[model samples]
Target: MNTMTVTKSVVMITEEASFRIKEMMEHNEEQDAFLRISVNGGGCSGLSYGMTFDQNSQENDVLDEQFGIAIIVDKEDAAILEGTKVDYKQSLMGGGFTIDNPNAIASCGCGTSFKAAARPAEEQPCE
Candidate 1:
C-alpha cells in the first residue's frame, strides 16, 4: 500500500513556481538536492519561512510531492506549513515564489515571518 499521500492541506505548486524549481534543480551544482521548508525564530514580525535546497532529509522530515517536485518539511514544522501554497506571481516590478499559509494569523509585509494561529500561547506570548 502507498504509505505517503497528498492531503487536503497540501502545499500547492504553481506553474511558475514549478518552472523555477525545475530550473534550480537542473542547474544544481550538488548531486543530491531537495527543497526544504522550516520555521525560524527571526523575522520582522516573529517567525520566518526558510527555504533552501538540501542534499539530505532527516528521518522525521515530512515528504510531499507537488508538480513533480519533492518537498521536505520537518515534523515539528509541518503543522505550520500545511495548507500553504507556493506560488509565483510576476509583475513589471518584481516576482517570486509567494507562500500563502492559512495557518498564519498575521504575516509581515515581507511575507517571510508569520505567527501561526495554532502555536502555543506561551510561544507567541500575546504578540
Candidate 2:
C-alpha cells in the first residue's frame, strides 16, 4: 500500500478567496466553522466540487488552516483535489469563487462539473 502523506498545502486558497470565505462565514453565522471541501458524482462531467461551512469534521478528514481560516477535506476527495487552487475574483458581473484543479481531465461549460484524471489502470482508448 502507498503511504504517501498529504501535505496541508495540497489545496491552496488565495488571499482574496480567504477574505471572501471569512465574509461568507460571518454572513452565515458560522464564523467558527470549518470550510469543508468535497467532490461528488452525477455532474455533467461526472464529478462536481462542493464547499460548505461545517461545524464538525469526520474522523478521517484532513484538516488545514490558511489565512486564518480552517478547512477540511475528505481523504478520498483529496486525490482529485490535490494541487487545486481556489480564488475569488471581482468584476462588473460581481464576485465569485474560481477553482483551478490540476487533476481535472475535462470540465463542463457549467464550470463546476469536471472529470478527474483517471488512474493508469482505468485509462483505455475510446471506441
lDDT of each: 0.72, 0.80
Q: Show pairs that collide, candidate 2.
A: none
User: Best candidate per lDDT, number?
Assistant: 2
Expressed as tens digits, the lDDT of each residue in 44-120 for candidate 1 is 66787788888777777777777776777888888888778888888999878888888989776655567876663
Over 34-64, each residue of candidate 2 has an lDDT whose tens digit, in order, gives 8888887756677777999998877678878
Clash counts for all predictions: 1, 0
- What lDDT is reached at residue 96 by model 2? 93
> Which segments of candidate 2 are over 4 A away from where they belong?
1-7, 118-127
